[model samples]
Target: MLVISGAVQAGLAGIPGQSAELGISLTVMGSALAAAGWLLTVGWRFTRKLPKPASDIPQVEQGIRITPNIIRVVVIGAVLIVLASALFIPQVGFPDAFPILGMLVGFLWSVAAGLACTGRVMKTGRVMKNSADLYARWLSRR
Candidate 1:
């Protein structure tokens, strides 16, 4: 969003009589297309390979371990931050402040949320792996 905002501002500022609204719309639409393309690629890769059954798949349980609470909290926080950034950017105290402040806040919130979620996922994944290994050993001995 910040990226689009900055592009729009720059584009409008560069033109002699271009409408800021028009520039903003164009930049946002272009960014949406790029984002959609990236999402498609990720979805394609994610669904391309199917895992085998648990009994035949090593470390399968590791993938199942997820912290729903932390994920939800981080997601909510990120959404709030993005929305706040978008709304506040235009109202900032100085000219040209929106591009810098808005982008910085938005990116920082996103990065922070991602890191929190990743930490939870990593911790849960490790616990799951340990449990799975212990369970497999016990079953083997039985």
Candidate 2:
């Protein structure tokens, strides 16, 4: 994500005028979307390498999972993204900055908090290991 963000910043560097900035932003948006698609594809391929069940069916692995040391990163990232986006919005749109700032902050709160909590949950070895073990069992059965 940081790498992609850096690429976006590089893409937007020194572009003058709203029209130019808008075009650059669109390009960055498209590129990021494409990259997300590619990443998802890669993740799918990676999970596919595991063994399959003899029954020729895929089974879902149902379990709780957790991770640690992610909340701070997420909060920091949220603040950064919100700050960057809010800074861009007034330049991009002619609206009052307060409403935009509020909106951005609200979005940041939700996504950052959600992601951080999710990551923290996944960090718990017992939960993630159990999930992986279940998945492995299903794969082997296949």
Candidate 3:
């Protein structure tokens, strides 16, 4: 970050307009790459592929039924998502990205809640047949 910022600053000089924007863009991308490389080199767990547990495969391979708890979570998540969307409406306009962020949080909460409750994954109107992934996630959380 420091190196890219320093190099970009020195290169920018009195050079105005487009070049400066380009330099800024380059600096941002370079910094991102540098950070990623550093993480990879320093044993970042997420940098490698996750190992699949053999025992975790069966539930995913076999479909599961949704439960009443999952339905409740789905409705709640939907309501939260709708309310989050409302915040972005012009009439209710707020000057922040909180609404956008909330929508994501609501969606993730719905999915996770549904999984934890019934071992099911829900999209807008559809339920995924797999429960192995959910079971594995639940196991990891424990």
Where does candidate 3 stray beyond 4 Å? 1-66, 84-92, 102-106, 109-142
If the candidates were sorted by their lDDT against the true structure, best first, what order would they fall in?
1, 3, 2
Q: Provide TM-scores for the models.
A: 0.35, 0.32, 0.23
**lDDT of each residue in 1-142, candidate 3, tens digit only:** 3334434443543233223444456457767887888877786555555554345343543424445455566667767775866665565343233333333444455455546544434232132334456657867886
> Which residues of candidate 2, in runs, are more than 4 Å off?
1-48, 51-114, 117-126, 131-136
Tens digit per residue, CA lDDT, model 2, 24-136: 45446757887888898997767747543233112111212222234455567768876786676676463334333433444445555666555544445334335556778
Q: Cα RMSD for candidate 1?
A: 9.9
Worst 10 residues of 2 by lDDT: 56-65
Deviation in Å, model 2, residue 103 alpha carbon: 13
lDDT of each: 0.54, 0.49, 0.49
Assess the local accuracy of residue 74 in candidate 3 as a C-alpha lDDT between 0 and 100: 64
Judging by TM-score, tell me the better candidate of 1 and 2: 1
Q: What lDDT does model 2 reach? A: 0.49
Predicted structure with the largest TM-score when compared to the true one: 1
Error of 1 at 72 (Å): 20
